[model samples]
Target: MDRQAEFVLRTIEERDIRFVRLWFTDVLGTLKSVAVAPAELEGAFAEGIGFDGSAIEGFTRVYESDMLAKPDPSTFAILPWRSEGPGVARLFCDIQMPDGSPSYADPRFVLKRTLTKAADLGFTFYTHPEVEFYLFKGQPEAGEIPTPVDTYGYFDNTPHGMARDFRRQAITMLEQMGISVEFSHHEGGPGQQEIDLRYADA
Candidate 1:
């Protein structure tokens, strides 16, 4: 076996891993997971796991429900947030037809194909996303904006407010997971926030 692949197999075996989580995303970028016991890893690698593609959004039709998920070993990483006590890590999979052809509709595959085109043209595609989201109480009604969870503005401190502390904790966790944060600030919109991640090679 290759050095890196051998190293990963050895690490998993030595760590007493009980489960291997296969991770992937739907067309809309929603994260998905399928966990298998360690005993199944070898089989999974040799023969991709079968799943019903029709069940996933924008995957396939009912008549052609058969599909496979082939794990990409390189994306293996311990999910730091999952409280599994450290022996477990995840591998992202690429979707394929039951016959083992790449699923063109897979969003990750779409991105990969686009990047390949860029390579053929002597350029590379890069993406740096600025994530913006809000933490609201329950679900707000139409045309009705929810009130800010806290009155803290920018770096202002409101003793009773948990939002400021939450942001700090979130940034810390992101850093722990190796994500570089360029900056974070309270957006002009009430209860809205923005986090700018540093641009880097993927």
Candidate 2:
């Protein structure tokens, strides 16, 4: 174990954390999570908790269903939405085979493999995702396209703009999780919005 892992263990106790969720993405980039009681965290960090990989679309075949999720200490963050109560935290995990090998189907491992290749070639790469999204009034019914919150155009500013407030809140939450926000603005399309993340080393 490293200092960062030790620190996480200590912080969990000190904060009286009720649950710690281990998160990982599947091959198609869908996030998944499994919560562990704080008491089990140390063991989880050492020997990952098992899961049925076959059920997690794109993970493993039913014949070899067992999978392990080993939490990455550095990616730990307290979910801002869950911070006010019993305090739920989360950590990104690297999936592994039962034999302790990296699972090729894990999205994080795939990125690590690519980054390793880049490093070997004496090159460093950064990834920045500028996300453009629309703000709908509420959840849409099946097959129904929901209405936009407003008819704002690019860089439109109004005294009362729902998208503006949304951007502020989203950036605040992301910053609390130690993620950086480079920029945010309304897009050209009605209720469409965009937020750019700071480049992260690959």
Off by over 4 Å in 1: 1-3, 84-87, 136-147, 153-161
Q: How well is each residue in 1-202 modelled by candidate 1, as lDDT tens digits? A: 3455566567678867767899888888899899988777766776779999899999999999998998777766665565656467778898999878899878879988888888999987666768776766666799997867754455443454445566677787678656788877776555667778888754
RMSD score of candidate 1 (Å): 3.5
Write one digit per residue (lDDT tens) for candidate 2, span 1-202. 8899999999988888899999998787888999999899888899998999999989999999999999989988888877576989999999999999999999888888998899999989898999899998989899998999999789887457678889899999999998899999889999899999998975
* Steric collisions counted per model: 0, 0
> Residue 196 in candidate 2 has what lDDT?
96
- lDDT value, residue 39 of candidate 1: 74
The TM-score measured for candidate 1 stands at: 0.80
Candidate 1 residue pairs in backbone clash = none
| Candidate 2: segments with Cα more than 4 A from true spot | 140-144
At residue 57, give the lDDT of candidate 2: 85
For model 2, state the Cα shift of residue 90 in Å.
0.4
Cα lDDT listed for each candidate: 0.75, 0.90
